[model samples]
Target: MKGRTVVLDHIQGREAAALMVDGILEDFLIASDAPPIGTIYRARADRPVKGQGGMFLTTPDGPAFLRQVKGLAPGVQLLVQVTGFAEPGKALPVTNRILFKSRYAIVTPDAPGLNISRSIRDEDERDRLLEIAHDQMQGCDYGLILRSCCHGADDADIAEDVSAMRAQAEQVMLDPGTEPETLCDGDAPHVLAWRDWTDPAEVATAAGSFETHGVLDALDVASGIVEPLPAGASLFIQPTRALVAVDVNTGSDTSLAAGTKANFACAKALPRALRVRGLGGQITLDLAPMPKKDRKGFESALRSAFKTDLDETILAGWTPLGHFELQRKRGRVPLAEVLK
Candidate 1:
């Protein structure tokens, strides 16, 4: 309970994964009815929405929207990968840049190159990985990326991972299907837990791990509107039709530094709150009433906190009305929406 713990379990018959740090829910994932990110499809190009600068395609699942498309005629078959979860009444988000990702490697069909993750800083280790890459991808044309997880792992395991990804990519690329169909399914929550959560942690995969490790309780709190912060502060995370509105409050304590402290507290806790609740898209933060001079400190705290976060986040600058904005990718369906 004092360290990182990964719990792989089920919630309401859907597979779920939870990452707990010191008995607190740090991240959460659950399956949904919509297509998960990374799903590959052989789709038929449909009508283009020129006004929106995107094209709608037909897939086995449903209609998907691909952005930045040009001159793609209707009825032409091409591969597309799901990039993100769809917003309400929108087409599934798909991209032409297909990537086959695993625990230790990623194969990119569009970007052709062999590279290693920059996090593996040791020169000798990089050379060793490069050697393995050369040997495995001798005649391959697709791009290959050795993930940071390859560091300190067994060479055989790394080799096998790269080989597996390359094979899958080749098979999908060579498929001669003329109709809309699925090429590959996305990794489920439990699989994502192992692939992305690379830090050393105690693993619990028992049937009742969620209940035994208190993930269920933490999830119940995360599903609510109020999220507790340090020094009796709180954040009201409310999702409106347009965006997620976060209102910060300095509860009880009214010290001169209360606003600054509460702002910093919200900065640190906001990522975890949004991650656990699976809330993303436009995020408007109405931070505590702090002095303008403290804005830099608040932004610094926010940047440092989200630096290690898994999902993509763009910290758009503060608004004219003192509100901070963030554009976060919708990686998964909302937890509340899923349960409902």
Candidate 2:
């Protein structure tokens, strides 16, 4: 309970994975009916939206939207990858930038380069990973990204991962399919747990591990609106149709620094709260009554909190009404929707 632990289990008869750190739920992933991100598809261009610079494509799952389109003739078949989950009644988000990602390596077909992960800073380790990349990706034109998980990983395993990713990229990129098709299925939740949770931790695979490790209990709290914060502070995360509203309050704390304390706690706890709940899109934070001078510190705290999150979150700065705002990518389906 004091260390990092990963639970590969099922929730509501659906495959799910949870990462717990120091007995707290840090992240959660569950399979959903929506097409998973990272799935590659041979999409056929349907029609472009006027004045939107976007084109709609046809996929096996459903209609997908590709943004920033230019001169894509109708019926043109091209490779695209699922970028994120779609909002209700919206086209599935797809991008032309395809990436073949694995635990240790990511192969980029259009981008040609070999780069080591910036986290692996040891020169010797960097050199070793570079050597592995150079050897495995020899004569390959595709770009390779050595992930942070490559640090301290076996050379053979890293080489194998790189090779497999490169091979998959080649096979998928070279396919001559003239019609819409599903080229590659995305990695599932359990596989994602193994792939992304690279930190040293005890993996629990037995049945009902979620309950044994208190993951189910944590999830119950995550699904609710109120998220308890430090020092008797609290934040309510309510997902409305337009945006996620986070309201912070100092509960029965009659101290002079109560507002600052609650605001800081909200800043630190916001990312994990949204992540565990799989909430995304527009986010507006109504912090406790704090001085204007403390805005910079609050912004810094929020940035530091989301620095390591996998989702794409843009700290869109404060609004005219003193509320903090952000735009987060819909990387996963909302937890409530998934569970339902």
Candidate 3:
């Protein structure tokens, strides 16, 4: 397994971090603009908007909206997790279904169940993890979902992580009087990008001013420097409100075979670009035109590349116009906006 490196570069006039996996830019982190996701809070339901099918809650950080009321009346207290941050005028999005995440697993306090990660394809490992969850959760009243990182982890380590998460969940339940505010601050973007997006033996961190690293150069390329690619191909990424669009153009070489190779190369690089830029939500890839029979192979290659994404990503198949559609779970603001 290749070790992932986290480079914190303050040269951009802000606290920016990048996740480099096997020398490829996997993700970017900006500490200034976006509010951390997964922050837990205990809030009081302000009022129910019967028409909107949701209720507003008051929290220490600010107001949050619960998309579903769930029969809770005004003034009823509820424990919620910060799902999304506030937009220009929108309130933060919160959910009653709380999940406490640890280094190896996620603990769901509102439900009691066990779910292995879909990324864990090995039946034996999945079964073993399930057994561990059952044994550890014997008397516990919370749910456990092993993260992808838990694959091949020792039983003792998994047990320890579960125990710690359960303790945190217990603390939250015991102290229901927590002021309507963020009870626990979420992990930093760098922490999340490393933990969720990469596989590494160890992670190292540094502070203060530092010299430019190769990751910085990758950032420059991603920001539109037209980095060189295989077979004289160049990639362009455009971020928009609706979705991120990627265009792959072959350099001067107008041969059909060259175009096909460039398109395939783009398939391999597009996922890394999306992750590196933290460009989540809808994504459309406009690759050079290829034969209809080759579409399946191209799509398969793209799917394999996206397997490393931290959040769930669905390839919605190619459109009639030959553009590929993809949807990724929205966890934070895009890095482009954050940098701006």
Candidate 4:
């Protein structure tokens, strides 16, 4: 872990990991891939349950449980977004208005009764349901997590996740069967690890160039670098195994960002993270060895670069060997499309 580092810190009966780079705290991850719940599904209407709760909508799987009016107003159709599970290991029949709770999610054959279940009810609550679905689709662009990655996230982040779910659902509605039975190819463990980056704060604050400082630039740099390569590079990228190696050599003559040149150099390197799209692992950087006085600026620059993916980046101070340690987030293999 040269440029990125992650240290586990236990807080309040739970374990919270602090991501740092060159000794700066960036992001934190509580749980990994918990499950997708409350995702909307376009389901066929099952007979309404007179009492107890709502109807059991027929999803791609089988009957999905729905609540009639949990979060709806009285006299309204009580259109609640779909929630609950169907039978496990059941392939859902693809049909019109088959079964879906909202715009965010669809009931997949995988893990129906388990987590990642989908279903939405409440006709009047369509607005809310639509909102969630829309968010789910655009969540990655907006730095929001999918419901599968939503556990222990704060309210604001959770809201982003809900939105991602909705957005994804809407896309399904607009064009059916864009993908096969599965929406996404099963992502690798590293992809889930990388998704832990992206600070909600960075998404909120900072505009334009400045706003791009945090996860945005990092992701941008990583993606840019990794996607465009001559075929058969023989380099395989993986969170559990793959990592990027960066070596910073101080120019013989100091002509770059004066005063805190070391820090400035680190700033310049920020975009490289995104260009390469490296996540959930270590990146080692050997900073151009500078005099003791130039150290402060170098430290500041390193800290600032992490704000983009602050949620998952870790910075540990220079090591005795004079190398900087950084732990970045890694995700599933970059889609073949992105590589081109």
TM-score pick, better of 3 and 4: 3
lDDT of 4 by residue, 272-315 (tens): 33323424356666555566676666667767766644235677
The 10-residue segment of model 3 with minimum total lDDT is 204-213
Per-model TM against the reference: 0.98, 0.98, 0.81, 0.33
Clashing pairs in 3: 60-181
What candidate 4 gets wrong by more than 4 Å, as runs, is 1-243, 251-263, 332-340
- Residue 218's C-alpha lDDT in candidate 3? 72
Report the Cα lDDT for candidate 3: 0.75
**Model 2: what TM-score?**
0.98
Better structure of 1 and 4 per lDDT: 1
After the best TM-score superposition of candidate 3, give how far the Cα of residue 124 lies from its true spot, in angstroms. 8.6
Clashes of each: 0, 0, 1, 98
The better candidate by lDDT, 1 or 3, is 1
Q: Give the residue spans of candidate 1 off by over 4 A.
A: none
lDDT of each: 0.93, 0.93, 0.75, 0.39
> Candidate 1 versus the native: TM-score?
0.98
For model 1, give the RMSD to the true fold.
0.9
- The lDDT, on a scale of 0 to 1, for candidate 2 is 0.93
- Model 1: how far is 206 from its true place, Å? 1.0
State which candidate, 2 or 4, has the greater lDDT.
2
lDDT by residue (37-105, candidate 1, tens digit) is 999999999998968888899999999999998889888899999989987798999999999999999
Q: Please list the Cα RMSD from the true structure of every candidate, rounded to 1 decimal place.
A: 0.9, 1.0, 3.7, 18.8
lDDT of 3 by residue, 1-340 (tens): 2566667556456666666667766677666554578888889889777789999899887788999676788888778888865555778888888888877878898777899999899999999999988888789878899988889888999999888888888888778574575677777756665556546634445653123336656766666625466878978778776777878888888886876888889888776666656666788878887788888888888889878666678999878898888987666666656655
